[model samples]
Target: MRLYIAIPCVLLALVFAASGIAGITRGWVLPENRHRVRRLRLYGWGQLVAAVALCRQMLFSTVLSDPDTLDPHIREWGILSGGALLLTGIILMGVSQRARGARQGTGTP
Candidate 1:
């Protein structure tokens, strides 16, 4: 269904964004291109968050409709996996913000 396309899209995006960040950190990027890279990272993160939310919502709807039919282990795994992904994405945003702040020379206490 929609997930067949959505999941891979998100995974591919995340991989691409992570690699882009690595490239930037290693000075592969030009000084003037910093803002563009930051924007791309934010867009990638938003896509990832939306995809996770969509998955969690789908699982919730499915589980509630046939709670007894689906395996309990699956329900547990889905909840855990979705939650972890959401949290990780949020934390990555925080790290990204810190990096941006440092670049602006306003990150120090």
Candidate 2:
């Protein structure tokens, strides 16, 4: 079960991180709003952070199965940091999405 979850998490992390790097370095993925450089960077950073948090959560799950192998304090910190990053990333992405939608006249403000 953990393996199944881990596989998808790893794949998503890779995709998001790659997209983030491309967006930050070359602005490759923001085809719809190419003019919004700041928003693009924000979205990219959000994706990167989200990817890291996802990987961290995946690692935590794996470690949780064999709790004796790792320290409890470390696991606690991992969960805290992962949750915080995930939340922050999601918020940034949401803001970007909302801005894009408003610009496109989607009435998403």
Candidate 3:
């Protein structure tokens, strides 16, 4: 049960990071185009949320903690997911900015 939850959580994080990269690559061709990026961005963020929730579940699945002290595996998973979320968020933000600039006809980097 715990392993199952952990697997999806980490996968989601990786997916988030991968989606962000895809969005950036797509954005490069047409900076103003936001349709694909918007959809992918939502997926990425959703994955991050799911990852956190799933990871929390894995951590507390057995001897559920009230305060949720960090178990070693939980700590590592959390850090990985958090980093992926942060990186994806940053990439999405940059893409959004570029989209805005392109829409404004500025084409700012």
Candidate 4:
């Protein structure tokens, strides 16, 4: 069961990492889009942090004494931290998108 869950988590982390790198690289194509590049970098950093947290949790899952239970403080912290990281990454990306849209006159402020 844990293996099944871990596989998906790892895949998700990999996707996040890849997308973040792509965004960071894509930001460099134009000189006038400096702010867009900055926002993209911010979003990318957040996603990378999230990916790291998820990978850390997955790596530590095996050493945990009770994989099925969340009674351990360390395990609980890992879960909560991962959740927080994921949320932060999503929020950064959303803000970046909104800013980009507004700048393009396609979104309302």
**Quick one: best lDDT, which candidate?**
2
Clashing pairs in 4: none
> Which is the winner by lDDT between candidate 2 and candidate 3?
2
Off by over 4 Å in 4: 28-38, 56-71, 100-109
Alpha-carbon lDDT, every model: 0.55, 0.79, 0.50, 0.67
Best to worst by lDDT, what's the order?
Answer: 2, 4, 1, 3
Question: Lowest-scoring 10 consecutive residues by lDDT in candidate 1?
Answer: 24-33
Residue lDDT tens for model 3, 10-109: 5775664455455444433234444444454444444344445444444544233333565667666655675565566555454544433335556778
Candidate 2 lDDT over residue span 1-109, tens digit each: 3788888878989998998888778766656656554477778888888999988888886647577877888888888899999999888776765544446576778
Candidate RMSDs in Å, in order, are 7.6, 7.1, 8.5, 7.6
Better of 2 and 4 by lDDT: 2
Q: Mark the regions of model 1 whose C-alpha exceeds 4 Å error after superposition.
A: 1-43, 61-65, 100-109
Error of 3 at 4 (Å): 1.8
Best by TM-score, which number? 2
lDDT of 2: 0.79
How much does candidate 2 score in TM-score? 0.73
Q: Per-residue lDDT for 5-63 in model 1, tens only? A: 55665566556555546554453433554555554455446435645654674554443
Summing lDDT over every window of 10 consecutive residues in candidate 4, give the lowest-scoring window: 27-36
